[model samples]
Target: MSTSGKKATATALAQKYAPQIANKTVLITGVSPKSLGATFVTAIAVSSPALLILAGRNAAKVEETTKAIRAAAPHVPVRFLNLDLADRESVRKAAETVLSWEDVPSIDVLVNNACIIGSEYKLIDGCEAHFVVNYLHPFLFTNLLLPKVLAVKGRVVNVASDCHRWHHIRFSDLNFDVSVSWKISQKSAAHLHPKQNGKIYNMWQAYGQSKTANMLFSLALARRLGGRGIVTNSVHPGIIQTNAASHLDPAEIPRLIEQVELQCGLANQEITSYKTVDEGTATHVYAAFEPGLKDHNGAYLLDSHVADPLEDPVAAWGTSEADAEKLWRLSEKLLGENFEW
Candidate 1:
């Protein structure tokens, strides 16, 4: 599809599925005003949820988002919870705070929307920065809050990316310590170099793997919790220009975009194929509340509907039951605790 066509489709989906959360309590992570998470809070608040909890590493940014939501929907209840996804301790503390809310008996919707991309390589909990922050943190946080979600038959919406189609998880060297590199060849397939001299880490590859993990997590969670009435799904929120890309070098962004487009079979060399923040949040909102999705748990949503994982090899890996189970076990090992579902 052309860039303009994609944008139109995104806008239409946002308008068609603007369901309100009503009396449900919703918790969303990554609410910096500059990102799509803030727009998500605004959308949920306008729907008049019972309570809206905004979480982010930056207390000030979370406060900013909360204030705006309150100002717009004064009748809707709003709260801010400080959360740093880079630190497992912070994730646990944040979960504890949510679990301690005496008045809010259940959480009806949990949006794991926070993520980082194209940042300098770092480690958290002895894992790659992107892997920990984008995948492990959410994995732990969601498991910690799973009981509350199950109590309400809640929906878990993970904001994954279509870029996940470009790469699969590197289980052997997830930390990039072996100097591996992934390049999208002209054939639109990812090729890996096990030993690339002077290239310690590839941020784009790490981002893709992290997003693939998000989809796998959703699939695994859905399978584990399906009978319990909780729903989990991952969504490609239509690439949008947001602060999530702030850490990326400006010139590199276009190059990465071009690569993704090629992988997705798009001819657009220009990286302008993106949705507005409002449009980008639509798929997750749809996944969070659309009753039609009740039976579609573990689905990867694109353009506001279930997308076929067979469309890409990396996507297939993400939706693989075996891979999901493997990732779940690895996550438990890394977190040093078994997640009892």
Candidate 2:
């Protein structure tokens, strides 16, 4: 169980665990400037890991992050891995490239952190864009790279969120097509509505559904890796200023902010009081190095501690064993491959 209170900062944790980070190879996706992933890598860079592999879709953005890392720690060895989470083939190629890299050691910390946030309805390869990019692709990439992670008995960190409480998986209506989504109800079967009400798709719910999958996927992977000395956990990096929500209309920003505050019980505080990018990166950095988490595999971390279901409603629903297995099967079905491991 986790206690509720102030959280540790990423820089402090990195300094405290410098030796542990020094010998490990870390891979993180979505390392764009001002984003959580970039901040996370920056924090890790100071400690001089064996190798820092930054991955993303844009070469320029990844280069930008690489420059920042160089400035922070010039001697740190950093490499770029071209990864486009929206494209399944790109993910496969990225994983294959990693597995084939003879110069790099086994991945000691695999952080599936890149994600997109928006209200618009779009599809990738006939699946919902949010579902595909946020959950499906990372799911594929992680499983494909399991060999590297397992070789070092490394841990996995899935950047999930508290927003998951806003909606269920919508198993029957994954795309949230207005025509099909309207059919779901609170009275629907467990697979259709896991504690969520019957409602049409909205920007919040769409993002929520994908985030829920992140947590469930963490649980499923942990179960499968039983007794393997590998810890897999999900984290809710606190709300912070980032470009993730750029897809939403500028005018809708305030409304979206207000909604997030209210839903996450921060409505009483001002927007400026939201966590800074470095602060938001704390729990992620903490999760990556915290040795105590080995006994708490499949846990959801928040504010730099394992989240308590009593303190956060999302914890219980996000960790449902049944939901985890269900989402795992569906993910395999969507990818047209069964991961026997």
Candidate 3:
């Protein structure tokens, strides 16, 4: 499909799902202005959800998003909560606060939209920063709030990326401590390669692996929660111009863009295929409320529909029952909390 066609389809899906948001209690993470999360919150607010919780690490940023949503949606109830995904304690406290809410009956939707891209290497609980911020944190938070979500048979929309095509889970050395050097000859193929100077950590590889984790988590969660009436799905929101790339060095942007274009096999090298924030966020909105998706649990969505794993190799790996189960077990070990459900 052409870019314009994709955009139109996304807009139509958003409108189609708008009515489902009314009176639903929705909680979304990562709502900074112009970010995908903010776009989801704004689009959903039009339908006047009963309560909208905007979560992020920065209180001021969350407040700014809240103000914008309120300005556009004066009647919608919007609340902001400080949620630092890198810290396990903060995630726990935030989940506790939501669980303690006296008036809110149930959470209808939980959008794990918060994620980071290129950044210097760091560790949280002995895990890579991208892996923790993008995958583990969401895993912990979602499991923590499972009871509330189950109460309403809610949906969990994980904002994953098609960038998962670049890498798969590095189970042996997830932190890049031992298995650092790697190469992606083509966008679809990536593997470890010995470096002359020893291990060399690459931020892009870390980011790609983290995204793969998102898909794996969604598949595993959906399988586990399937019979419980709760739905879980991951979405590749397409490439979009967002602050997600703010951490990238300015000189690297052009090269990265060119590489992405080449990998996507776009004929016009001069024209990038990035989507506007609205079009990029539409799949997330669609995945969160599409009634037909109830039977499509554990599915990965692209362009607002269930994507074929055969079309994307990384997605195929993510959907592997064995890999998903391994990831789930590893996550439980890392978090020190075994989820019963």
Candidate 4:
């Protein structure tokens, strides 16, 4: 839980439960085109599973990603499904597809790796972008697919991040109507460049919010699912610059100072702490198919190993009956009662 900007300095990861992935079914959650999602999907495909599901919202993208997976493991069983975690109907349909698998093949591994970075305070079916993309989507997808995953007593890997430390859930205003961002004001004062303008405003704040939500969601999931023989843990996939950064509208435009004060923005650095797609998927790949610590069910990992907090145990969240109840109710509100759990 060390939130320092530094990537995990330690190299050792916990593997007390290693060797549990022999001939197990693993699902990479975000196998979209041109993404670390594809990288993870390809890596796992090479492992040769009984069944591989390359899923995403884009049909062509899924086809391309699955094609890459197929090229890597020509003989491995693979299927591509267009899955939109942000949409309830799409999620439900995906569950049906997953449940209809032949022989009801157990899902041994699941990576909740889908994410989006939006700063416009947009809403997806009334849910905020950060909360919806980072937590609720994965939460609903996991809950709906539990039956398919539980049979194998699978491991659920959540791709969280240390940037989470930048902020916490403003429970009151999860939406940005009144939320804070570094783009316009710093401690109530304007940023260094008041006259400057950018298409994506407060990109870091939006990202930090989403990242924090991911950790909390992971923590809660780990606690709730750990006792059921399903291993759940979160990992801060080292800053492997994914398309997530491009999610924001990045166009630096000049604007009046007074006008900028109302809606100022940011100009993110072109080069971030990016890693190769393979390197980016290292943490997830280890969590998915690697054999070593298969029994360490409810723990956090960094640098592909168990990352016990160097000092204080960070507060991600706990998935108690009460918390689960709250999360579900809130999700329902976000999606409306018309949506199924």
Candidate 5:
């Protein structure tokens, strides 16, 4: 509600916090060419961070992001680590690699930005693909690297989304059967094609649940690290046309929006608008380096400011303390590790 007229642009914030970002070691996951993660890397590269580590599954794509940063900011140091979010061993290996770097002992900023948005039903290590790649693995990777973050009393930014308001954590069935029919209004069902009418594997809704988990995870970590001086926050980077949405057919976008509106009980209101990649990266950059946010741990950011639930229409379920604690326990149980902060 304190937000004035327009959101602060990434360019302005980068310049304002150049001193804070300079010489700070930053690590970001899910970096790839033309993606939101890559755009975020580019935005911060201009500030000349001491180190920038890009983590992702595709080595070549991650390299592309690195090359672009090199071209623009030749003096900025950049590194890449092979990371497969769906694989527990790969996530652990990536963390170990960062820990072993004698030259770079601590990570000043860690951005868990990698995610998959898909409608297909697939399992990775006996867990649903979206939940594993988007939520569980990030949870595991962050916990593994907590020591590095603690070394400098750094910041952790989880790139969540406003779409999280669409669904709550399906605690009872985190791996719900996507093939089953999802009950909804007849009007909302009318928007889907005949074949997709009763299907519950709606890509956006599934993605929403994972993003909600991201917010909850940030809340839980912030609570545990309350006075340790390590700031943790979730961000809703503006909507953008990136590779993350490649699974969705372009032609179906309008109908999909209609489905979302109908399901959320918002009949005719405009729900979203597209953003340029740079525009989309503003909030992520804001959450990562903005000195003003040092005292606002566990905050959810939108448009480069702490989001107010009253003004933003963010669902209470996404920020529920009870749900955050429950998800934290579930994450430790599923990973078979105690991540005591």
Candidate 6:
């Protein structure tokens, strides 16, 4: 409920505390050998946590990152866990794996730093891929491990984006089943129209919705978990080039970039809005272990400093006391009784 005398955005805080990235026992999801996720992983590699769990879907990239981390600090133990966020079971299994690791019971920090753009409204485990991978999966992943995090009273840093402001999440339509009579997936996703009249929406529309959900989740988590000594905040890691674009329609990527450039007044191919992967990773680092946030809790941070989330995401997502309560219950409902966490 208090600022803890801190004055920095997620980006600024990361820059200020660049030295703390090493040996911090951080778990960065979606990390790769050559991505912003990896860059953040490398930066924090210096902090040298007793253990660093480098996770991603690719075993090869995870191994490459694990090797790089070990080379950077021979004594620091680095482990790898392959997780497919799109699959709920994979996320749950990943939680079990991380919890079972030695020296991991008391986690120091959690960086929900995975995201994507230009991907279609495809379904993963029957939900939109962008929504599931970017928000729902991570939300479940975090709540599942929340006990471990709270046990150590650690920091939670969620990576969010400004694209959240682009569209409002249709919580009612998230399933995309009602519109298609319950048939939704790669095949149906391709045919699922997201626009009426003349416009370009659909695929990225769901993406925008998910990002907003992430921000709202961060806001809600900050409020709900702050009292537990767990400082939870979200960040916009900046628009940097990464493989997240791989799933995006290649031809449309350039067009979207061009539009964003004009709106932001940046030069064509300027890369101004985008930073190096290392730079992008800084915000997450700031959130997880920045000295400034040592006394912080329950605040949404952007770039590294505490910034208001895109408009009122909590309100947009579900601000009603009843709605928030309902969301928790709904989450539990979807997760099933097997997941006692």
**Best model number under TM-score:** 5
Q: Write the per-residue lDDT of candidate 3 for residues 178-256, one digit (tens) a residue.
A: 5433453321222344322214567777888888899889889988988998898998887676877766665666678
Per lDDT, what order, best first? 2, 5, 3, 1, 6, 4
- Ranking 1 against 3 by lDDT, winner: 3
Q: Is candidate 2 or candidate 6 better by lDDT?
A: 2
> What's the TM for model 2?
0.88
Q: What is the number of backbone collisions in each predicted candidate, taken in the order shown?
A: 0, 0, 0, 11, 0, 20
Flag regions of model 2 displaced more than 4 Å.
1-7, 178-200, 247-254, 257-272
The TM-scores of all predictions, comma-separated, are 0.86, 0.88, 0.88, 0.73, 0.89, 0.76
Which residues of candidate 5, in runs, are more than 4 Å off? Answer: 1-7, 178-200, 266-272
lDDT of 1 at 94: 93
Q: How many backbone clashes does candidate 2 have?
A: 0
Each model's C-alpha lDDT?
Answer: 0.78, 0.82, 0.80, 0.59, 0.82, 0.64
lDDT of 5 by residue, 118-214 (tens): 5577667766688889999999999899888999999999989877876777664565543323785333444443433224555567778899999
lDDT per residue for candidate 1 within 1-341, as digits (tens), equals 11122343323443444454678888998889857888877766766678988888888888888888888689988888889999889999999998998997899999999999877778776788989989999999999998889888889998899778656777766776564335433122213444332155767778888999999999899899988998889988876778888766665667777776576455644556557777777776778877878789888887666786455323577788898998999899888899777
- lDDT measured at residue 138 in model 6 versus the true structure, 0 to 100: 91
Tens digit per residue, CA lDDT, model 4, 127-176: 56667767877777777677777787777777776555444554434554
What is the Cα-based lDDT of residue 214 in candidate 5?
A: 93
What 10-residue stretch in candidate 1 is worst by lDDT?
Answer: 1-10
Q: Which stretches of candidate 4 lie over 4 Å from their true place?
A: 1-22, 179-203, 247-273, 290-296, 311-329, 332-341
True-structure lDDT of candidate 5: 0.82
